[model samples]
Target: MNASVLPYREESLCFGPESRLIATLTLPGDHPDSALPAALTGSAELPPPHPHLHQASRTSAHPAAAGRAPQRRPPGLILLNAGMLPRIGPHRLNVELARTAAAQGVSAIRFDLPGLGDSGFTSSRLSHDEQTRAAIEDAMTLLSRTKHAPDRFLIAGLCSGADAGFQMARDDSRIVGLYMMEPYYFPNRFSNMFRTLRRLREYGMRRSVIRILQKSRFTRRHDPAADSAPVPQAAPEEGVRAAPTPQHFAEDLRSLLGRGVQIKLIYANTLMGHWDMRHHHRHIFSKLGHAPHFDVELVPHTDHVFTRVEARRHLIRGMAAWLRRIETQQHASAA
Candidate 1:
């Protein structure tokens, strides 16, 4: 795909001194005077703090320039993920989202978690929880120092990153909106496990299940052509349950609503082993009395990673449309 048609620019950024988070910052064609909105992706290794030397340099040079031209810092949209995969599946999705958002005047960013990508290795330094939250905090701090400080913040996540994104929305009042794509909250490698277990159950080959997981890793090895994705031998035992009740989607939504933040969650329509991810999504959202400042959407025929180019585009377009709606409402309300 020709990338030049995309609206955003890729940038290298860090939140703090000990942090090595490489983020892509995208700005609207006309920025600064605009109401800034940011989107962030989640990562497993939280980013440490860093100074906005670029923003600082501009400010220092403009001591006498005050309202002269006003720094046109871009509104931000951040992408959060636990780690980098072999291919840029999620990264491509986020970049497309940023491009679409920028077309409509929203700035977007997608960054590697602390230890991933060009950032220094803190890879296994923090738990998924700490890393995710820290990434959000870093994004917020960066936003604050930019020309668009105080602009509303929007966050988006995938898989474990989504789990952390929800946690950040609950903890931070400044986050005005959230979008989650294919949140992997199902217990264990629920979908894949279910598929494998069901296949084993039907064939009455329970013993072979372990062997399959072990052997599959060698054959799969991150190949896009592999029929079965590679799995680590030590990859947590199959069918293991997730801790803390998987952060009930409803509860997370309620928390965001209570703070007056809008949240949109999208789940993949795939069976997670014995568990149906779609059913879980329904169970969580059906009980909500009024959408709880949250909206739920399901993307058909898409997997957790959203690797297919068409699927990625669809996800990005959906996000762009929702963001535009939110911006329109905010503008109308302000007017």
Candidate 2:
């Protein structure tokens, strides 16, 4: 397929009260009509139906005879922002991913959440959770109106975007697959500290000491409770909440898995300080212990945002392969 010919449309989608999100919707082109087979030499004639056979039975055997419509494809992809990055993604990763995926026959929509990118804030105040949920619901509603009217959805995001995607999959059954890059998985303090010490040892005593001093100074400067003087705790924001504990994350993962949601978790090497390594996923979700539904990949020599050219290429390829796998699985199940 000449990908350049694929059609795409850009529009402003309204979601929450007084909020408008900028989005681009891409559609896969229809397959070229097959030339009628040159009249086959002596093609076998079809057998006549039984005298009492119902019209429905005949139609079922030959759908075209009754003008039965072709089955609709599943929902298209949804690309989200990473942290405060716009829908273009860091280094235009989201745009690249969407276009490449579209070339592969997976339609996609990349959009900005309210108050982020080009989107406007809601009329009324909404917490982070509320806003995330509402924005996704709105995106789904918009996609549902497309010609495909896709009911099942796949969501991909990086960092905080990944966090929101995970939360959405947990809450919504319609979400069938999630692509998460450097998602916010809480670290096990003891294991994390051990790994940090091991990493420091590799850096030699001199550099490690300097790093420790810098870390200590940073912690002391930021620790309001470290001072002898009594200080009042800052109040939490109206809609913002504390990060979820490992237990909460584990439970959520288990729930999504039980619901047959396919998940891909890619962690950049920079996250080793917190996530330690791929095996640490077991530490976080001991009960789920390497469930098949969860596909985890560790990107070596990469920063959280995959800023390097090689790293970006690696990310794109990895995501494309995973998306293809999910597509195959969906088709198999549907069949």
Candidate 3:
């Protein structure tokens, strides 16, 4: 029997001052002339811009544009480095995702930030945070040129990468959608209670008690908790940052939603507790799903990086499906 195959064209991208920044661009293989994507064919109609989304006059820092129909060009996808991981991402999830997207007629790029992977730091004297954003901006410029001016693009990231994507989306109008894995989880009293009860149900009192103690000890020793990313210099990939207070995180999310960004937040049961947005956030919003622009998903038995094959497959499928849905909705809105 022959092995199954997926088609794509992959190339290395080296940009920025001294060309120190490195990235991989994965473009879809040749499409049948008869079945080119709408972006290529110039068939998608541009919808009227949302007044609240972006002003025609000025540019500044803020989340992505309001949920506006994308331009004639299909949205380019930027797969950010997961935490300090290189472009390959945890378990090569970024590679797999880029391939999947290429097969679906989307272009995807995975790159490393300065001090991570093969990418060297820029010569600029900007602060660390400022440099990171500047590097990303350079990537957008280069990627836009390669893809020939995509009207907008999507940013998908995990952990620290998720944070980078979120910040850039807020500042750049070209970012139209975000897929964040294990992003900013703020548990409340009810969520804490639910977790305790869930632990009891799963392990029973005796084992659950032992497990809790063991986990506490484990966290103290190795400390993989979401809030505490180890600070050792050698292990860059282990880095992560805790989000700001729940109030601020909530406000950020709402602002992005109002701007018409389509956000998909996925939480996993890694060391970071099984936090579902429904449990942690439903109380905050009148009805969590009432917002049409965003959705939250909770996945079980998946580690933070999705090491397990089936778990990772599920994650990829959900992402691809969400991307398709967003495009479909944009087309519908334009119609």
Measured over all alpha carbons after superposition, the RMSD of each candidate to the real structure, in angstroms, is 10.3, 11.0, 9.9
Worst 10 residues of 3 by lDDT: 49-58
Q: What local lDDT score does residue 12 receive in model 2, on the 0 to 100 scale?
A: 37
Evaluated at residue 131, the lDDT of candidate 3 is 74
Q: How far is 35's C-alpha from truth in model 1 (Å)?
A: 14
Stretches off by above 4 angstroms in model 3 are 1-6, 33-71, 189-240, 271-279, 283-289
TM-score of 3: 0.72
| Candidate 2 lDDT tens digits, 1-335 | 33223333233343434536667665544432111111321223222222221111101221132474665466568899887889999999998787666556666788888778888776757786787787787777666655445677889999878888888888788898888888865555466677677678689889988878887856555655567777566665433434577677778878888888888888887735434664465656467766667877778877889998898898888777877787777678778
- Candidate order, lDDT descending: 3, 2, 1
In order, candidate lDDTs are 0.58, 0.68, 0.71
lDDT of 3 at 310: 86
Model 1 / residue 101 / CA error / Å: 1.9
Worst 10 residues of 1 by lDDT: 38-47
Off by over 4 Å in 2: 1-16, 29-72, 190-242, 271-275, 289-291
* TM-score of candidate 2 versus the correct structure, residues matched by position: 0.72
Give Cα distance to truth, residue 41, candidate 2, Å.
Answer: 33
Measured against the true structure, the TM-scores of the candidates, in listed sequence, are: 0.67, 0.72, 0.72
